[model samples]
Target: MFSHIILGARDLAALAAFYDPVLAALGLQRMPDEDDGGPAGVGWQLPGQRLPQFFVQLPFNGQPASAGNGTQVSFLAASREQVDAAWAAALAAGGVDEGAPGVRPRYAADYYGAYCRDPEGNKLCVVCWG
Candidate 1:
């Protein structure tokens, strides 16, 4: 449904530090530094695929990066364990907990997910559907 999703960040290095491990937990690998010369940022995508990338970078407007209210990005996990691992990685990498890993029956009978805010306060969710 999307080509890519980019989150604005004030600190590119800090964003990489937080996203590297967290995305790894969900089996996403950071793309090699091709230095596209577009902007200062980093991106990650599922191994061996090209589209649907996730990126964190400075705002193009040259202003401070701020999280949009009610905005969120959700990633699909292969299993509940991946959801837990991603959540753990997020918190360990300077993210804050928004919700712990658990079943969210309200979403679905097999919904298991966790939520956290990135170091820059962007909301994220890791979810698994059994």
Candidate 2:
């Protein structure tokens, strides 16, 4: 339902470092740099697909980037293992844990998810629904 989701970042390189491995765990690959022409940022999408991209970039308004309260970006994971891998990768890449990987029955019986804040403080969730 999204053409793209862009998170404003103060440092593009640092944000890329955190997202690269985390998205890779969820089966996303970085889009070619040549495709990201509008802003100084990096984008990721499912391999061979063009839409539904996720990007981290410097603010377009020439202001400092700030995380929005009560805002989050969630990615789908293929399995519980992928959720774990993504969460582990996030933490290892300087993300802060919001919730550890586990079954979240409140969402669904087989909902497994992990939550974290990116290095730029953008909240993210990786979830698997079995």
Candidate 3:
């Protein structure tokens, strides 16, 4: 029953720069033109879908970042390579490795995945070939 997701970033410019190429690699496109009134930067849209669009706005105005505050956001990949690439990209973007990429039979026999904390410390994951 979810409609959309928005995350707060202390640095919109940094977040945008980090996510642009990384998400694009997964076929997600940044919404064009709109600049959420400047300080509140906006982007984040999946490719080829006009509806059910999701956007992530940056900066929470001095509020504490809730990145890895026990919250996890997982993205699916088409193959193991994508998972690896995602992990590397995330690390390059200031993501800290929470878990290395591998199968977690406890989650599922084929649950191949990697976990990381975003710049804001939000727990994130990428998975594929599961």
Candidate achieving the largest lDDT: 1
lDDT of 3 by residue, 1-130 (tens): 3555666777767777767766765667788866445446656666777644444565457564456456787777788888888888888878889998899888889889999877767677888754
Displacement of residue 8 (Cα, Å) in model 1 is: 0.4
RMSD score of candidate 3 (Å): 2.6
Tens-digit per-residue lDDT, 9-115, candidate 2: 99999899889999999889998886445668888999888889998988889899999999999998999999999999999999999999999999999899999
Ranking by TM-score: 1, 2, 3
Compose the digit string of candidate 1's lDDT tens values, residues 45-103.
Answer: 99889888999988888899999999999999999999999999999999999999999
Q: Is candidate 1 or candidate 2 better by lDDT?
A: 1
Per-candidate local distance difference test: 0.94, 0.92, 0.72
Using TM-score as the measure, the top candidate is 1
How does model 2 fare in lDDT? 0.92
Model 3 ranges off by over 4 Å: 35-39, 51-54, 59-64
**C-alpha TM-scores of all predictions:** 0.96, 0.95, 0.81
RMSD values for the candidates in order, in angstroms, are 0.9, 1.2, 2.6
**Count of steric clashes across candidates, in order:** 0, 0, 5
